[model samples]
Target: MHKNDTLNPELKHAASTESGFTLVELVVALLVISVLAAGAYSRLANTDTQARLASLQSFKATVLSVAAMAKGMCISDPQCDIDQYQTTSSTTIEGKPILFTGRYPVGLAPHGAGGLDQLMMPGKFTIQPALSDTNRATYFLAGAHDERHCKLEYSITSAQSNPSVLSVTVDSSGC
Candidate 1:
């Protein structure tokens, strides 16, 4: 054999054989991973938003029920009776306090409007005081379900001129 062609057949075969993942295959895998990650992120964000909305709806219901309870207490005239600001709850917000300004806890039997006199998490709620006075009285109830997680507040505006304003707002401070 000529010196220039001295390589063994097995050695030549080995050199010709390729090894490792293809660039195309690696790119495809990366794309799939990215897509899956994006999908997971999107799902998480949507779930968070839904949870917030549900909590808000619950708060709205609580406000309405409380209003009804107050109305019942003053069957003759609810306008003048809902003036008292009562704080009854298991928490506090903005250093104020959480309170239940309703009557009977519930109307008749079902027990309570929300199974509880107040709809608040412990250490998370407040009722703003009314000093000046206006059409009725307003209270700002705020609290957090978790630190750096779910901080929420209710703008409870009770007025004789306009229907009571009950609003709930939430911010992510907890998970």
Candidate 2:
């Protein structure tokens, strides 16, 4: 008691007050931070799938627009034979020869003439001929896991009225 009384009041107060957190408090804080980080990471992970889906939608729109324009050009040109489905026809647009079958642009090259590839602008996707079907052009998202599942398939429809079909398939696991 005498030694304690000899010490200054300010020094005694400073010694009694703790400067840092206890082990239990530190552990709880770490746990909360970890939980928040986990939640944030999960949310961020979903954004990639969303981004790929959006890209696919945009690409599909571009493909539809290009197909329509090519069809219009085919209809306007006297050389394009829209009535003949058995025989392939072609017309030049912007200096590129676009191959067509019954008023619709073919999905792939036909007899060395350009199809969908010539119409579409270069994008961030990888374009390849679909393995399952020769008539389809499959566009895969760059860095995607399952190329077949996560892709946009552009194919020429048999019916002249429909002309073409754009199919989008996105597998979340692939993204």
Candidate 3:
């Protein structure tokens, strides 16, 4: 037998075939994986902002509900006046006296006793100081990109004569 013929048949066949990924194939696979990863990352990044906006919407609903309940209580009580916009009033809820301005609940106070925070407890949010006066309150998420830009503002009309205005505005552009 010759020297070349002495080699194993399987080894010679494998060497001739050379079955493996080429450089182009490997690069394409890597590129696909990177694209998929980038898409997933972008979706994940937006999820946080969506979550914040949903939370703010839920909180706004709660604020509206609380104000409606307070106003209902005020209307039912003969002593309480719902039309008085300039004067602060009180209504008993859950055996606790909640103060109100016209038909809307007031914001947080310095001593942390009487305000909208009392009615709706701050669960995952941080209650900031009352803006301008006790009528306006701002809430921020616990961990946000910019608290000032991404926040929920609750304001009640006190001195206005038109009607009681309980505004709950959410600014989630910076969230």
Which candidate comes out best when scored by lDDT? 3
By TM-score, who's the top model here? 3
lDDT of candidate 2 over 12-112, digit per residue (tens): 99999958999999999999999999999999998877887787778777887887888789889989865644346889989988887666677778556
Instruction: State every prediction's TM-score relative to the real structure.
Output: 0.41, 0.75, 0.80
Residue pairs in candidate 3 whose N, alpha carbon or C atoms collide under 3 angstroms: none
| Candidate 1 total steric clashes | 11
Which portions of model 1 miss their true places by more than 4 Å?
Answer: 1-21, 76-125, 130-175
Would you list the C-alpha lDDT of every candidate in the order shown? 0.43, 0.73, 0.76
Is candidate 1 or 2 superior in TM-score? 2
Give a tens-digit lDDT track for model 3, residues 24-89. Answer: 999999999999999999999989888888887898888878878877887787666746666777
lDDT of 1 by residue, 26-110 (tens): 9999999999999999999778556655654565466556545444544333433344334222123234222333222211112
Model 3 ranges with Cα > 4 A deviation: 1-18, 82-84, 109-113, 130-132, 158-160
Ranking by lDDT: 3, 2, 1
Question: Would you list the clashing residue pairs of candidate 2?
Answer: none
| Per-candidate clashes, comma-separated | 11, 0, 0
